[model samples]
Target: MKTWSSIILAGGMSRRMGSSKALLEINVQTMVELLVEVLTPFSRKIIIVSNEKDYEYISSLFQQALHVQIVTDDPLYQGEGPLAGIYTGMKELQDSWYFVCACDMVKLHPNYLVGLQERLHTEIVTKRQQYDAFIPYSEGRVQPLAGLYSQQKETIKKLLDQNKHRITEWLTHMNYYRIEPSEWQGWTPISDVFFNMNKPEDYLQICRERGK
Candidate 1:
């Protein structure tokens, strides 16, 4: 079976953090940079979608990956959220599945991703399934932002046709599978690794955790 591709969703408004969340630094590296590093081994390609103004700095981060496209949304589709980025990335990628991730998850543990990897391998080995989506649920809730999508070209067109702009809303319309967090062992703090930067205090706390 062919390996799937990935796209990192980096266009959040980051209102509470009061700046671009994609640019937030943790351990001397930008959040998006860290995310790209993690996904580098797994992705066939990496794409970034945000306002052109917001991406100029980020575009320079990967000097070697000229193959990784950094795209700006068409003004007509401004502020439509992560779904817009997902649509844009899926349109350009040839892979049947795309692993999409949010940039703000700095505390993310590698084990969570390993769990998803195991699922992919299982699907390939057992069912030989052709799923349209794969999302993980930790403690009964789905993390739509951190999930794998078998982003079929036809389904993407349907989503665009419906004018769906929310990730959660569209996930409801797809044929997908969700795994309980416990299904995977060695999973770390559900909250710590998923700590979303909300305010100045959150950044301070994360800095302290990093021993800064």
Candidate 2:
């Protein structure tokens, strides 16, 4: 029930995939299009961060939606990875909370956000400590791209200025609430919900699995 904006990181080089993952089509919808569709209901604004070349094309895709904004990574932090993407998105929108996702994720589970919101509300009711981020831990790793973040642009900027661009590394400096398997497994299996395509074969595998 908190004010939420959505940020989709779409600027990866996609070197392994051999093309822009954001532009990849599933059935008829591009990855970004699918993400936008799923996120619209929960977001007041949706920001897609791509590189310079993809900016115009992505912008054209969402011209009719006033709440969606397509942007290029900031000139200073361009190509710096997911941390830069997160900073660019948080900088673009002033919303208090942001649901950040990677464009490569094929089947993002909306229930994750719904459950996280409920947990946050419970914390408020019980007067428990809160955190700057609500991240998921799956397969023994933290999924920062699938996390919800508080406005931490300054923290991100400081880290990037110091030449630290890894998102997992940046998380160490923030107070975060980690959602483990026990907390999220009831909604959906983490593997299915957070399956990200890193190569052509991964895409093919996902398509085959989904009967696409």
Candidate 3:
């Protein structure tokens, strides 16, 4: 298995949820904790990007998980959105590839991730293509956070430098391999893996679905 690093974007204000979604409990685990658990087995390092105020609290929460690191948004890109958080993680690890996701994601399918890794290997090693990212496109939308990225720290920096915080816009400037819905639909229901809670109602809905 190739080495991989993971980045969890948890810096959002959670205005709609009225609280920190990262701290929300699901199946007896905090959102970030569950995400860390999922990534720990496959990741060499897992970075949680949040505000500086959350550094100590998040660090304490993951004390037993030594491989996990918590970081504040880069000063220049504070509150810039998921794109900035992604860039911060890329800078910290400087790894060849990254598996990025949002803190509110309730279920992450490991089988799908494995498939993405295999696809990435084929493109970069077998086919000798220079793709900057491997992202999933589902439900007529591009899921940038639930995607794998190449070492495009510089490219991201350029975007942030230009005050461009939109992830989709960043993709346009790079050579990316997009996994369409047709490619991933058979493995599992895409909605389950990509489910994210953006509001209190969404959280309640997840709780209901999970029989919590």
* TM-score of every candidate: 0.87, 0.94, 0.94
User: Which order, best to worst by TM-score?
Assistant: 2, 3, 1
Q: By how many angstroms RMSD does model 1 differ from the true structure? A: 2.5
Residues 75-113 of candidate 1 have per-residue lDDT tens digits of 545567777778777777767778887777776676667
Point out the worst 10-residue segment of candidate 2 by lDDT. Answer: 185-194
Best by lDDT: 2
Candidate 3: list runs displaced more than 4 Å: none
Better of 1 and 2 by TM-score: 2
Error of 1 at 140 (Å): 4.6
RMSD of 2: 1.5
Deviation in Å, model 1, residue 18 alpha carbon: 0.3
What lDDT is obtained when candidate 3 is compared to the true structure? 0.85
Of the candidates numbered 1 and 3, which has the greater lDDT value? 3
lDDT digits (tens) for residues 1-212 of candidate 2: 43589999999889999999999888878889999988887889999999887888889899899989988888899999989999999998888889999999988877766777777667668867878888888887998888889999999999999999888778888889889978887766545687789999998987787678
Models sorted by lDDT, best on top = 2, 3, 1
